[model samples]
Target chain A: MGRTSDAREKILGAAHSLIELRGYSALGVAEICRTAGVPKGSFYYFFESKEALALAVIDDQWATQRSDWTRVLKSDAQPLQRLRQLFEETEAEQLAGQQNCGTVSGCLFGNLTLEMSNQTEAVRTRLQEIFDAQVDMVDTVITEALARGEVTVSDTRAAARSVVAQLEGQVLFAKLYNNASQLGALWTNCLALLGADSPHVPTAA
Target chain B: MGRTSDAREKILGAAHSLIELRGYSALGVAEICRTAGVPKGSFYYFFESKEALALAVIDDQWATQRSDWTRVLKSDAQPLQRLRQLFEETEAEQLAGQQNCGTVSGCLFGNLTLEMSNQTEAVRTRLQEIFDAQVDMVDTVITEALARGEVTVSDTRAAARSVVAQLEGQVLFAKLYNNASQLGALWTNCLALLGADSPHVPTAA
Candidate 1:
C-alpha cells in the first residue's frame, strides 16, 4: 500500500512538471508515466485518463497558488505595500526558478479555459469562477490602497484588470525570451506608475 | 498551367485555414491536402515539407499584418490618436473574423518563439529580428506621442516593451477565451492606462 501510494504521488508530480514545461495540450500519458518511472499500466491504476490527470493537476496547482498569494496579500503590511511586495516576490521567484508558469503561464486556469473549457462547460465555468475570484481579490486590495490614498486610478476595477494583464504579459515575454528581466522591468514600470513618491499627475503630459 | 496554379493556391489557403483553426502542431500534411481537395503528391509538389509550408504562411501573414498596422499607425492624425485608432480597428477586425489567428493563434512570431525558436537558433534569430523591429516601430510612435505631450513615462524603452507585452497577453487571452470580447476588454483597459478615451467600459461590472 505504501509503495503504491508513493508511485501515485510520483506520477502526479511528474505530470505537473511536464505540463508546466510543455503545456497541458502537448503532454501525453505515456510521457508522464515514463518521466515518473512508472509503468503504463500504473498510470491507469492511478488516473482514469489523461484529461482526468490534467484536471487533477490543475486543481492541485490552483490550491497551492491561491494559498501562496493569499498569504502575501493578507500580510500585516499596508495594502499598497503588500501588493508591491507580492509583485516583487513574484519577480524574484521567476528570476530564481527560470520558470514563468506560476507568475504568467497565462493562468493555468486561463490556459485550460482556452484549451478544453469550451468543449466542457463544467471546466469552463469552474475556470471562470476561479479567475473572477482572483480578480476580486486584487480588487479588494487595490480598493484598500485607494481608500488610504496610497494609489490613485480613474477606475479601480479597470486598474486591477490592467495589473493582471500587465503581469500576464510580462510572463509571456519572459517565456518567449527565457529570461526574467522583462518581468523585473514590468515590476519597475508598474511601481513607478503607482508609487506614492510621485504625485498623481493626471495631466503630466 | 492555370489548373496547376489554382491547385497550389487552394493548398496554401487550406493549410492556412487549418493551422489557424486547430494549431500548427496539431495539423498534418494529409489533413491539409484533404481539406484543399488536392492529392498528397500535389502537396509535395507545391511545398517541400510542412515546415516550408508553415514558413510560407508566416511570410504571407506577416506582410499583410505589417501593412495593416503601418497604415493605421501612420495615418494623418495625432500620434496618440492614431495609436488608439489602430487598437480600435484591431478590436473590430477580431470581432468580425472567424477563427482569426491575430490574437488567438497568437502572433505566429510569438508562438514560434515559444515552440520552434527554442530548438532552432535560426528560427529564434529570425523571430527576434522581427520582434525587435516591431519594438522599434512602437518606440518611434510612442516617442512621437511623448514629444507631443500626449503621454508621459519615466522610461520609453520599458513602456514600448510593455505595449508589446500587453498585445501578446491580449492574443493569448483571446485564444483562450475564444472570444473577441476579451481582446476588446484588453484594448479598452490598455487605452485607459495610456489615458485615451475608450467607450468600452461596461455599464455595470
Candidate 2:
C-alpha cells in the first residue's frame, strides 16, 4: 500500500513539473514515467491513461492551491492587506528556486481551458468551475473590503473579474517575457485600481 | 507564379483557422494541407517544416492584426471613445466566430510564448517585441486620454497595463466559458473603471 501511494505521488509530481514547463500537449507518458523514475507498467497501474494522469495533476494542484488561497482569504489581516499578502506570497513562491512561480507558466487551469475546453466537455466544465471558484474568492474579498469601507467600487463583481483578469494577463506576459518583474507591475496596477497603494515590495527571501 | 502564390495563401489561411481553433501543437501539417485543399506533397514544397509554417502564419496574422488595431486607434474619434470602439469591435468579432478568436486562443504570440519562449531566443524576442508594441499602442491611447483630462489616473502606464490585462483575461475567460457574454461584462466593468458606460449594444451588420 505504501509503495502504491508513493508511486502515485511520484507520477503526479512529475506530471505537474512537466506540464508547468512544457505544457499539456508537449508532455508524453514516457516523459512522465522517466521523470517519476517509475516503470512504464506502473504508470497504467496508477493512471488509466495519459489524460487521466493530466486530470489527476490538475485536481491535485487545484486542491492544494484552493486551500492555500482559502487560508489567506480567511486570515485575520485586513481584507485588502490579506489580498496583497496573497499576491506577495505568490510572488515569493514563484521566485523560489529562482523560478517565477505565480502561475507565470499561465494558470494550468487557464491553459487547459484554451487547449481542451472545446475538445473535451469534462475538462472544459472542470476548468470553468475551478476558474469560477477563483473568481468567487476574489469577489468575496472585494465585497468584504467594500462593506468595511476599506475599498470603494461601484461594482464588486466587475472589480473581482478585473483583479483576476490582470493576474491572468500578468501570468501570460511573464511567461512570454520570462521576467517576473512584469508581475510586480501588474500587482501595483491592481492595487491602484482598487484605490490602494501598491503593497507588493520585492522581498529578499 | 500566380498559381503558386494562390496555393501559398490558401495554405496559410487554412493553417490560421486550424491554429485558432485547436492551437499550434495539436495542429498537424497534413490536416492543414487537407483544409487548404492542397496536396500533402505541396505542403512541403511551400514550407520546410511545421515550425516554418507556423512562423509564417504568425507573421501574417500579426501584420493583419496590427493594421486592424492601428486603424481603430488612429481614427478621428475621442481617444477614450476610440478605445471603447476597439473593444466593441473586438467583442463583435469574437461573437461572430463559432469559437474563440486567436487573441483569445491566448494570442498566437502568447501561446507560442508558453510552448517555445524558453526553447528559442529568436521566437521569444520576437514575441516580446510584438507584445511591447501592443503595450505601446495602448499607452499612446491612455496618454492621450490623460492629456485631455478624459480619464483620471496618476499612473498612465499602470492604467494601460490594467486595460490590456483585462482584455487578455476576458479572452481567456470567454474561451473557457464558451460564452462571449462574459466579455461584454468585462468591457462594461472596464469602461466603468474609466468612468464611462458600456457602448456595446445590439447592432445590425
Number of the top TM-score candidate? 2
Write the residue-wise lDDT of candidate 1 on A80-162 in tens digits.
77776777777776676665343223345544544454345555556656666666777788788778887656566756655
Candidate 2 residue-wise lDDT, B71-152, digit = tens: 9988899888778788888777667673434334445665566566655666677777877877788778877876887665
Cα lDDT tens digits, model 2, A1-205, are 9998998999999998887776677677888889999998999998997778878888998999899999998888888877877777766555562354433465677666666666666777788778888879988988888788766566677677767766777777766766566666555555545644333431110
Model 2 - which docking category? Answer: acceptable
Q: Candidate 2 overall Cα lDDT vs. reference? A: 0.71
Writing each residue's lDDT as its tens digit, candidate 1 over B1-205 gives 8988888889888887776555455578899989999888998887888878877776777788778878877778877766667667766666666344443444556555554543445555666666776667777787787787666655566666777767666665554555666655454444434443333443111
TM-score each candidate.
0.83, 0.88
Per-candidate TM-score, first chain only? Answer: 0.81, 0.86
Docking class of 1: acceptable
- CA lDDT scores, all candidates in order: 0.64, 0.71
Clashing pairs in 1: none
**Candidate 2 residue runs with Cα over 4 Å from true position:** A97-104, A195-205, B99-106, B186-205
Give fnat, all candidates. Answer: 0.16, 0.36
DockQ of each: 0.30, 0.36
